[model samples]
Target: MSAVLQLLVLVVLAPYLVGLMRQVRALMEGRAGAGIGQPWRDLRKLFRKEPISPDGSSWVFVAAPAVLAATTLVIAAVAPFAATVSPLDGVADLFAVVALLLLGTVALALAGLDTGTAFGGMGASREITVAALAEPTILLAGFALSARVGSTNLAAIVERGNHSPGDLLSPATLLAAVALAVVVIAEAGRLPVDNPSTHLELTMIHEAMVLEYSGRDLALVEFASALRLTVLLGLWVNLFVPWGIATSEAPLALLGGAAVFVVKVAVVGAVLAAGEVFMAKLRLFRVPELLAGSFLFGVLAVSSSFFLA
Candidate 1:
């Protein structure tokens, strides 16, 4: 029941979160911006249009959006967003969650290559490159966090954090948080990594891959992208700031947890958006260096957990 509520909240609130981030960026830039409802309106418009496929595309192209969306939904359902005692808690292993995320990324990369367009191929190459660098940092950070608890289960990590607040301030935890923050930015294709708003062929990483998608396919892709961001941010919050999460199964506790979850995620998203306003995307060749630095932090985190124990 808690898992279902988390999934519903993610599906319904993800778009508005995107809109909120965009609005924050706009406001920072002194623009009035479109209202927060704009993303929902854009999604509705996209769903009403007829989907079109590229002439040479195969089943991979037709299935990538659904595959991507399905993987994200799975993560949202099993992850400890609102409550620590979810029905699917047994399956919420950190490695499994990371693998599911990579599966969606690989599916979309394959779809990009399947399109046979030069831009698609280029984007696929870049996306895979970024994923290769970003995903490992996520694993290392998760392992660092899980080391103290002796279990890779995400619920165990969060529940432990809730019960032991001092762990959140440890050297290992702080280092892992910094590493994962960079991973989230890279994985979500945000600025200083890949500009989500860019359309230029030379600069596009994620956008180039989906250039051929239209109508319902486009809507699914966009929504999945938004949900992925929300899931990543939510996971980060629950892992590092598990104070407000419900540890029990009571209805009131679950409701309060859900409300707190939204507020935390929104605050992080707004901060990220505001930060991006003052930053510029890194040169393509330099992105690997940034990710490599994050990976180093993950390594340091692991070392800190062992030595500082």
Candidate 2:
């Protein structure tokens, strides 16, 4: 039941979260931007239109949106949302979650390359390059957390954090969180990595990959992007900082946990949006260095765990 509710919350709230982040960015810039419901309106508009496929593209091009949305939805469904022991937690370990996320990335990359456009190929190449560099950091960070709990299970990690909040303040834990904050910025198409709203071909990464998608396909891709961000952010918060998360199945606990989850994510989104306003997007060649630095942080996190323990 908790898992079911989690899934519902994921689908229903992802667009609004995107809107909220955009609104935050706008307010920070002293502009009266669109409402927090703007993304929902955009989604509705996209769904009402038709999707057009590029000529010479294969099934991968046609099905990429579905692939992206399905995999992300699965990740969100299995994530330990409000409760540590979600209905799907039995099958969701950290490795499984990471692999699923990579799967979505790979599918989109394949689709981007499948289109055979200069922009698509460029986006795919750049996206894959970042993913390759960022993969080690993500795995090492997960391992850092899992090692302390003696299990790679996300629920175990969360349960451990909830029971021992001191762990959240440890050197290893903070380093992993730092590593993941970098990872999410890259994975979720945020600035200083890739701008989520860029249209210039040279500066576009995630947006370029979806350049050929239109209408319903576009909507699915957008939703998948938003859901991926939400899920990744949720995991980051719940794993490294599990204070307000529900560790029990009690009703009051679940409700409180849900409220806390929203508050945490909103605060995170605000900080990220505000930071993007001040941070310039890194040069394409410099991206490798940033990801390398993040990977180094992950290594230090692992080393710290071993030495500190």
Which predicted model would earn the best lDDT?
Answer: 1
Deviation in Å, model 2, residue 191 alpha carbon: 0.8
Tell me which residue pairs clash in candidate 2.
Answer: none
For candidate 2, the TM-score is: 0.98
Query: Candidate 2's residue-wise lDDT over 1-309, tens digit each?
Result: 667767887788789889999999999899999988999999999999999999999999988889889989888777787888676887788778878888899999999999999999999999999999887788999888887888888889898999999988899999999998999899998999999877987898998899999999999999999999989888888987788888777888877888888888878887888888999989999999999999988998889888996
Minimum summed lDDT over a 10-residue window in model 1 is located at 195-204
Return the clash pairs for model 1, or none: none
CA RMSD per model (angstroms): 0.6, 1.0
How accurate locally, in lDDT, is each candidate? 0.95, 0.88
Per-residue lDDT for 212 in model 1? Answer: 93
Model 1 ranges with Cα > 4 A deviation = none
Backbone Cα, N, C clashes tallied per candidate: 0, 0
The local distance difference test score of model 2 is: 0.88
